[model samples]
Target chain A: MFAGGGKTVFYPKKCPRVRPAPCEFPIIGVPTGEPLCTIPSGYRPNRKCTYMDYAIETNHLSKNYGQVCAVDSVDLHVQPGEIYGFLGLNGAGKTTTIRALLGMIRPSSGSVQVLGQPVGPNGRGPWRRIGHMVESPAAYPELTVLENLEIARRLQGVTDKNATLRVIEQLGIAAYRNRKAGTLSTGNFHRLGLARALLHQPELLILDEPASGLDPAGVVEIRELITRLAREQGLTVFMSSHILTEVDRIATRIGVIHKGRLIEELEADKLIEIRARRLEIKTRDLAAAQCVLSEAGYAVSANEDKLSTGDQRAIDAPEEVATLLVNAGTPPTRLAVEQENLEDYFLRLTGETI
Target chain B: MNTFIASFWAESLKVRRSLITLATAGGFMLLPIVGGLFMIILKDPENAKNLGLISTKAQLVGGVADWPSHFGILKTGMAIAGFILFSIITSWVFGREFADHTVKELLALPTPRTVIVASKFVIIGLWVLLLSILIFAAGLIAGWLVDIPGWSSALLWSSFGSYMLIVGLTYMLMPVAALIASIGRGYLLPLGWTFLAMALAQILGVLGWGEWFPWTVPGLLSELTGPSVEALGIHSYMVVFLTFVVGLSATIIWWRSADQSR
Candidate 1:
């Protein structure tokens, strides 16, 4: 759906596909039911855009083993050049969904589509255009890092032999290229896994727990690399991770899954919008502070050693809360506004509060 | 074709870099060396007595010091020991992927899972065949060193044919080990399967039903106890062939259908 009714096509003059006449645009389906812009034909088309603006789309995708459902009816839409962070706890169906998307497991019901092609039975899909690493980083322990990547590159149908060398340098594992994979440290092993995923210069990268063993610096490096791939190359990334802060920092959009179901999905900016913030106050007489804030029409509760209110009025004006507590003879000892971080939000959503 | 080549290369590299390769080679080398030792022990009874219990055991095991008896030792060794060694090779080829957790990396790729599985089988076949040839050559060298009597071109040709046939039959049974390794996803189950098969082969062969059982066919053909064609027939070959087909098809189906949640 590139052009709407009676709307003139807006073609960029500098577009590489600009011809002497007019550039032809194809009408494609997007989940949002809106028209999408067109890129040059030779350029990697929006991987997320087929009939929809989604590189990966699933409808009622569910997988059950015997009586237990590993992945419930989950709907996902990952747009091109957008890093969609799948946040979940362990056994939360993140890996199951990733496996289904890659066609590693047959869904008990529903379907999955990637890069505009349905993932066929027995793990057949548009794999040439998609790169992925599921679960743990795995390599032939007896083979060197370079050898392992060379295999991945070849199996990925990459013609250039130098791709292995390029990815090795790109992941900063050049020193260990000649070292056997079994000898690598955990972080470097993860880098080798990432290098393998990026070996074919795929348009879509699906990774599960990609940062599991990386140190803080390595995490940052991978984040920056993913960000650059999405920004500069228009790559689509669908990644799952338990590390909420890491996902929050790099993902354009995030989906939280709990107990084999997709519970929540939102833009990264909206994470702050939904996160619960509060005005917390400490006083000599907590009950008195609670009464005073209650009298001011703010819903207050006594929690542990303090009185807290989740009202925006109290949060925006903590000084007013302090003054009200003082006039009521509570004499506030401490008063401050606090906001919940992504981890807290995630924990609360998953009903695993700390 | 490109994906096939790539997958073949990957499987070959893993096989080449593995210690199992050298380990299996060294293990098979024992067959010829032990055969040569038996010949030396059988050559002279007085010297054999001076050599202690080893000579007595060799005399009991090997009847006479000659090219026929020596070749018989080689044939019997390949038939019996080949089962264990070839099963170990098949187990390592398939099981090591799961042991190393590298199977996941192989699951979703431009190369089909069937191609990867086929490449592994091809590598195993080539490796087992090469080892068979190597051990046969070693046996010939050992026979020449011992300078056993009854050496003739006709005997050599007959012995070589027998050696190759027994080795082939042993190799034919190894795909079952591959299937077991794939289903069990590690070394233990396949090794267990090999031992169980060997035990059952012995019992079945003793029960006078060796021809019908695929595992017993190799041992019967090797004729370690003496030529007893009454317990075996042409159906024995058919049974072994069917077992191979079944094991191979089951392995491919498992790779294609099983949920690789691990």
Candidate 2:
């Protein structure tokens, strides 16, 4: 059934701020003729369509170009008000999955539903609520920054004229508002792209490398902006990035895909918890330190100039290793424990060295 | 209706801001100005030669200096040069989205992709029609400035009809340009197709089979190659209409179903 026109089915547990419809069920968990909450304003939710909890849900979604599998049997469930970071190496099917999610590309096999509506055979989806920036941010270079955002705002069916101005200030492209987009710096161009995505105040923001061309400060600003939106406005963000640090900073949950398969999916805290930790002890007497640590029953190895251990005991008690080294007359120059960062963890998971 | 309005507004702003709009307008106006200069030369050939305005080596303007001659020049220019200009406009209208990599932005909006495509076609039609009117008006001004004789309401109305018919035929052929722009995903391929079609139109027109070729239909209707009635038959229009439907459907289908991997 087409969205926005059908018999009401099921009850509404938490009604979105839709047009109030008189209901015999007392507006409790029943789908009404009114628009669904979390759907962008222009959309008309099919009342007969049952409610779905997840903002984005996919089942066994696979996309193959010829014999090469671009995405292989991926199932994803992203809840509302969550920031799900999609991580992958270059050519790792992150983009393919994103395109599928946006209905920009068809799935070779399987299904995708966004905001409870099936995605495209002809660019059909819950697009009103979904603002996406796929791959590089492409704008009509001949147009000014403001004009570009205005276009986005109108096409996204945003009736508010100030929406474009708000996003321009938010993305800090106000200075370039009147300048042709082709002439903007890469960072500003990226800002303009982001501004366009944010113009409609969407419930879901699907960004691919959203910070690709930004400077360090610009990257932090974007990170903060995304974090604020998801926190304050209850927005859902499904962003794909190869920049591990960027994902680590903002992503609440991380899904790592490699060679067209999702290798791991975990909460950010859980990812940190599972990352390898090592104790490194440096001394003037490296040989003496190694022997002392080895004799102390720590699984010690040499990494370049320092003696390191993957032993949990050594990691848990760096003081113990330090005391042993000092008591052996090889006073430690440095002693510290280091946990794997997202980059190291990503590289390790992808079977690559730092 | 709302989506169409929004899409149309967006499409209009892009065209209004582009340098191509001004460039095409300037290029289109040259037809009338040149044709008027030819009328002046033909009006007084001896005086033009003495004044170095028309050298002895200058080519003849063919038709006598009158309203019909002026209208004929305008009509023929609309058919020949208008095709290229119209193709360029069509290419930019559809091709710029891909050239600028903005097609993705348009694809997943609340507005349907088909609506967006239709809006572009509407804007393209309006833009070309506006240019046709501008050129025709410029032709009138040029004729008045040249002070050509033999003007009458009947001749004027008939000329207007012929001019419009020629332009309508040219406009019908633009969908092929839109299709090439879409499938090629940029301006170059469509522009290349335009040049190829123009070359083929000349070849086929010379070979006495121009009536069947969609690209040559406007040239035939212009009555520059032969009598309009003989140059075009009922089947000629059918072929043009078929090309329009096929090109338009192909563009929409490509937008609807093709993988937008780019």
Q: Residue by residue across A1-354, what tens digits does model 1's lDDT show?
A: 233443322222123322222324443323233434444456643333324346788999999999999899999987665699999999999999999998888899998988767895475888888888898789887889999998898888889989999888888999999999989999898989889999988878999998887888888888998988777666789999989998999998999899999999999889888899988888888877777778789999899999888998888888887777778888889998888877888888999967
Which 10 consecutive positions of candidate 1 chain A have the poorest summed lDDT?
Answer: A9-18
If scored against the real structure, what TM-score would every candidate get?
A: 0.91, 0.88
Model 2, range B1-262, lDDT digits (tens) per residue?
3999999999999999899999999999999998898788778877667756353323343447788888888988998889999999999999988988889898888898889889999999999899999999999999999999989999989989989888888888888899899989999999999999989988888788889998888888776553354868899999999998888898889889889888
Question: Candidate 1 chain B: worst 10 consecutive residues by lDDT?
Answer: B224-233
Off by over 4 Å in 1: A1-52, A283-285, A316-319, A329-334, B225-227
Task: Give the chain A TM-score for each candidate.
Answer: 0.85, 0.84
Give the interface RMSD of candidate 1: 1.4
lDDT tens per residue, model 2, A94-189: 999999999989899999988778998597887888888898898888888988888888888888889888899888878889999999888888
- lDDT at B196 for candidate 1? 95
